[model samples]
Target chain A: MSTVEHTDRGPLSREEMAAVVARDIPDGSYVNLGIGQPTTVAAHLRPGSGVVLHTENGMLGMGPVVTGDDADPDLTNAGKQPVSELPGASYFHHADSFAMMRGGHLDVCVLGAYQVSASGDLANWHTGAPDAIPAVGGAMDLATGAKDVLVMMTLFAKDGSPKLVPACTYPLTGVGCVSRVYTEVALFDVSGDDVVVLETWGESVAELVDRLQLRIARATRPRGPGRLR
Target chain B: MSRTQFHTAAGGTTAAEAADAALSASGVASGMTVLVGGFGMAGMPVALVDALIRHGADELTVVSNNAGNGDTGLAALLAAGRVRKVICSFPRQSDSWVFDGLYRAGRLELEVVPQGTLAERMRAAGAGIGGFFCPTGAGTLLAEGKETRVIDGREHVLEMPLRGDVALIGAHRADRAGNLVYRKTARNFGPVMATAAATTVVQVGGVVEVGALDPEAVVTPAIYVDHVVDLRSTSGEEHAA
Candidate 1:
């Protein structure tokens, strides 16, 4: 796959972005989709993929949203949205469910972020607003416990500032936890103090570099056949 | 060396009579700590909380998952000016305005815990554990002033077990022996809380005879339950004739 776009091709829609993340999920993975935008990934999972969906509210093998007679009031997610239980689904107490999370049993956790440092520091829970209630539910545990921490968010804030920052300004969730980021503008493979541009949309490499206000490490393309190193 | 023995009988004139006996024996007084089981509205003991409201105790400390929602159940108790503090995970969901109002007014104290950490602390209390180290809130504000150590090169924080004077829980069915089974996800925190408190009182949907429940299906065994108030059997005809 080409990891760079030299020309400006534009941004992907929300549905397309969700589908892109869904396509990357491997079969037989246990994943926790965070509240808000990350929850949308549940509807896009490939059929019969053997991927188990887990909710932090003591449910594993959770199904997509249900309505009417199929909805069970007692079977809701952490977000308090009504959901259905798939076949082979199991329920446990709150502590055991959290053990499945903080004990490193989850394979992947997709979360929404307000800012992510180049070195993978995450800050999504609060913005330091004085009046905000500051409820940090399970974001910290999921970020640190999941094997692969994937962040899903928009590329920029509503005021047109970069979310991929030199360092997070808000309270940090976990240090060096995030490895990959899926945004509307592009997909990024982030490592120690560097963001590797794996894909681009609606912006050229140079433009993205300037917009991000941080260092962008471009993955070099392979040389043509018969060409020397 | 022997397993825990069961205490408490299915003898009362009415469901309300059973509830009154349980509430009185719970020794619920001003400034006592209570543990209630529920996630949002599910697994909440509505009638038991109502009886506590009528018991007229003030300055109570409540420990649960959420504070309250939409002015019912636990929220009603909070609205009645009976609660002085709340130890919970999510205290400000959309429907929990009762707590918000009291908290803003400096009447109710709010101590917010991480969801997983809260659950584990309660579990540790029930399992006879003193305390345990968890990796949930190592670098966050929740770890402030707490003991932290790195195990396996990862930071972990120590949290103490939480206990209460009384734990009020809801179950779908309970045999006269007090073996309880819950309905679906409503079983969220009921089983753990039942074992962690000094006394556990259950509000059940229905009552059944001994040996009616499958031996393998019992969730909270009879030893943990101190009393049961059957909501559906007020007339006592099912147990009689």
Candidate 2:
């Protein structure tokens, strides 16, 4: 397979980016939506699709976010955000929840990324900042044990540095765990061969590279011999 | 001696010395009931647990919130088939094999309790409360065999205090006086079970001089703690498993 690069015209809206990422998810998949941008996927799941959501605090079959008047104070996600339960939902011991993650029972785990290496290494937990709390909190277990890992984040840090780099500097959650990447600039796949950019938001490859002010090598051809669509 | 006095004898040892001393003093004959504290993999008394397993204490009843994760924690005892009965709040899917196989074959006795009620039951025993009432499990399978009562037109299930012959706990630090403090999630269920057992043994990462712990931070008072065992300071080589 070869890397595929597409162009980006301008800054795409968050909804537009979410719609693109949501299209990759298949029906009837069990997924763990990591805190932050990945959590938005739950709000955009395809209707009538049997996507079973798993939370680490022992609730299965989670529904979309609950709005005002329907929210219960006791019902919350792992991050303590109020959530609704889907039909046929059940609660088990918290240990059972970790077991499912560690035993490779989850089909997909969509996680927010601080930095992802070319070889699919994930480093999202800690930044070694002096004020940051050092809690791993099941991220290592989910990253390593989940069947397929998807990273969702912006392409660059707030300081305008590339997050997809040659190697990660922070503590890695797992080695070679990330399979796909969804960024504000473009959607990319980190395969065994190279970083293949799938689609850009209306910008040419040369223009997008110039806009980001990075000298990244462009893919000569699309990976897998053709475009995904 | 009364069971309370029997605990005082066990509590006299330092945390590092508690494991071997408890093992030697208890005369823990095979096939006995053992209650340990810790939620999930945290707060497990690794040193004491290792001693029990090494001592080949078999056919035991283990009462805890969880049977640890695989390769560590209480699950090791279950993997060894040393546990005959598990009274816990939840079992992880990875460690479900032990519960599933033994429970299905009638070889293991499994009892599930509501998480909040289980914590309260332990706390009640520690506090000298004979029994407490709650509506958590009423009208469910958990109500079966449990005493039921109605007060003010509200149904409540009576859950008796749970006390064991031995209680194992984990601590972040302990003083020579037996005052204990747990770090983060490791604090779950440890302080409660400390008082609910005939003999309460604590495993601490560090054993400090008396008065080393702040007076305000001691979660489990020295009065209720009997023994303190120091965990082996391995270079990450010896873990819960």
Candidate 3:
């Protein structure tokens, strides 16, 4: 039977999780940083790594966020946040940006998520509320077009609800699009049968479940693709 | 059933002539809303734009993705004071006189949407989906005055779709029957606006027989197209003439 194992520490700090996630990204990737926590990944990229950053507003080769007094108002990310330019950076028409995205030129895209299902379905667009302001930005295209997708989010909502669930009730951006997920509690791979907890932040399965007050099951074998519920 | 009268131009008309005939047939007048397709300098309906400007049209609302950089493209319309309002994603450039003057004076009624959402909204308008929701601009100034709702305790932003009476599109090639194909960056807003507008006019570099184009190469099918115009290059200056 497949057994679930536990680790010594409880939960990892946010910094630890960021570093761990950053380590997995390959060097020389063409990556699009989604808004929010994914934007922070730019600051954590290892030195000498040649990751090309793309903004939907037509800039490629963006540097990390500038601090102190070095920030240039003219240089900003898609979100209009001030940023520095990396060497060999260039700007083009916004049309060219989407062309790069739609043409399968991007290597990876990291995004924030509200929910990620065991089957790798992502629901970050809307919760389907009556008065909700809909802003389904390039997420649909990014979720479908990028070569690989990684989601960064907390293990649970502020109200203590699990963000990982059997099914997503929110409006999904793309079907079965997530490749991996990084959370403060664990690094998980969206396996076919269930969310396989690959690396725990020093906590046992039972203890982690208890602390988060959720139900978790151990699988005896690796679930094949398309077996996710 | 009552029917609207239609006129047909002689076959073998140049693409530019065909486009002019179609636009003229639409009875376009002053003070109309027209949506233009193209992203920045790529795939713009240079011929149709020139004709409209030369025809002395005025007080128009232009729905576009970006108001072109000054001195050419849609900026020409703004420069001529022909445009009354611009509903677009982003229309600002440092030295664009029309955009700067109207924006600073609040004379331009701008509806700013996220780039992706704007594309999808145009797509949704074309696809007949009324509205959709997303969280892209939640908690920012973009959230102001928008209807907000909480789903599962998380907030999302809502946006509505838009459609225009006339859509001016640029294409790399077209068939006599009006099937359109656009090259690289020019394809951005062309295909989407092609479907969402009531009248879609195409300007093309080359026009061929209907079936001569491969089935897969037809980016915007003829059903969405209402007219075709040919581009003419003159004086070592290529104008969508």
Candidate 4:
């Protein structure tokens, strides 16, 4: 949180955003990537990185997604989609799988979010729509359990409202759990008291601050319990 | 017939009826709580649930990971108006039309528990623990009225054990002693559900002789199992390793 470190480059594509998250994840970390876009991080991980994937269903050494001929109905990810298992993969019951999460055995968990409060509260599970059927899978457990909760999402809604807000309007999934946020437009560090702009793309810190209507400073350096720290 | 294959999926009007007869013989009465094992269709006991439909045990309570997927297994039972309530972690999946429709129409009751808490509740029940505190759902709507205390620096909520009248689980193989071994991820919920229920009935791919199974590989020891339904005819060897 210091000078106006600005940028005018184009916005990062979905793959680029995923790559940024991949680059940040340290090797040998036990991580859980949320079902959707967060799953893309797997493709960008380095070969032999030793970053073991933790599927909430009941596995530790999960590998790439498998489809068609290679897909086995018995081996699937938390999303219930077919996936491969690495050499060291092991399976257990549901309780033990979740125990890894609740017991704080996970190093990092990257998730997709609808809204993240300035104080790092997350609300991605439900929109509170009366007609919608609610499903709260492992989202709450990961948010509360991971050593670092990183969110990957678009900076703005389709209607152009900002997703990063002073306080979340939607129902919260977890309170003060998010440590960092990676968006297509910028990377933010919310682990501390202030929301620090680590870097920006397609938009400058000045424009983001104005549009977001919140106080943000250019990060002197990334801070967390990981390699970036 | 071997003792392990005592109740085979044979002799009935339909597989559902035969399965229902097994359920009936095991004292599965109406208005009881049943824990249905699976995480989607992986470890789901389809034959057993199809029997529950023919068993006609209305006003029954069911606990599982997902509610239903399509109009088969759990969905068929739910559509038959057998389940009065569903206690699950994630009920609304891509193919959960039966549950979605019934829920919207006010014909079903639902209690959504966090996946970790749901499993731990059952594990606690089997282990003889009354209740324990954890920090999975603190400060969320799910933990609204629950009792809470600050453990160390984090807030933890008290959760109680969840027992069942009966448990229906699927496994890859079992020995004559009723020792069970599962295939891959299908093992989810089966081991814990086995211990948390009063009478645990298992449907297996095949039954081996007493000494046929490797002693080190028995995931659910025979102590937790009460009945075995051999489905070796239909459970192809594709899942066997």
DockQ for all models: 0.58, 0.02, 0.06, 0.83
User: After superposition, which runs of candidate 4 have C-alpha atoms over 4 Å from their true positions?
Assistant: A1-8, A221-229, B1-5, B10-18, B234-241
Residue-level error in angstroms, candidate 2, position B24: 2.4
Please report how far candidate 1 places residue A32 from its true position, in Å: 1.2
Q: Stretches of candidate 3 above 4 Å error?
A: A1-24, A27-30, A33-229, B1-20, B151-154, B232-241
**Candidate ordering by TM-score (highest first):** 4, 1, 3, 2
| Model 2 / residue B184 / CA error / Å | 0.6
User: Which candidate, 1 or 3, would have the higher TM-score against the true structure?
Assistant: 1
Off by over 4 Å in 2: A1-229, B1-18, B232-241
Q: Please name the candidate that would achieve the greatest DockQ relative to the true structure.
A: 4
Give the alpha carbon lDDT tens digit for every residue of B1-241 in model 4. 3333246544434334445656877688789999999889999998888777777788999999999999999999899999899999899988999999999999999998889889999999989999999898899988889999999999999999999999999888888988999988999999999999988888887777899989998899988887777775443332221
Per-residue lDDT of A110-161 in model 3, one digit per residue for the tens? Answer: 8889998878888886666754434445666677667778889998888988
Candidate 4 pairs with clashing backbones = none
Q: Write the per-residue lDDT of candidate 2 for residues B114-179, one digit (tens) a residue.
A: 555666677677779998876544544456788889865756689888777778787777777778
Q: How much DockQ does model 2 earn?
A: 0.02
Shift of residue B170 alpha carbon in model 3, Å: 0.4
| Chain A agreement with the truth for model 1, given as TM-score | 0.92
Query: Where is the poorest 10-residue window by lDDT in model 3 chain B?
Result: B1-10
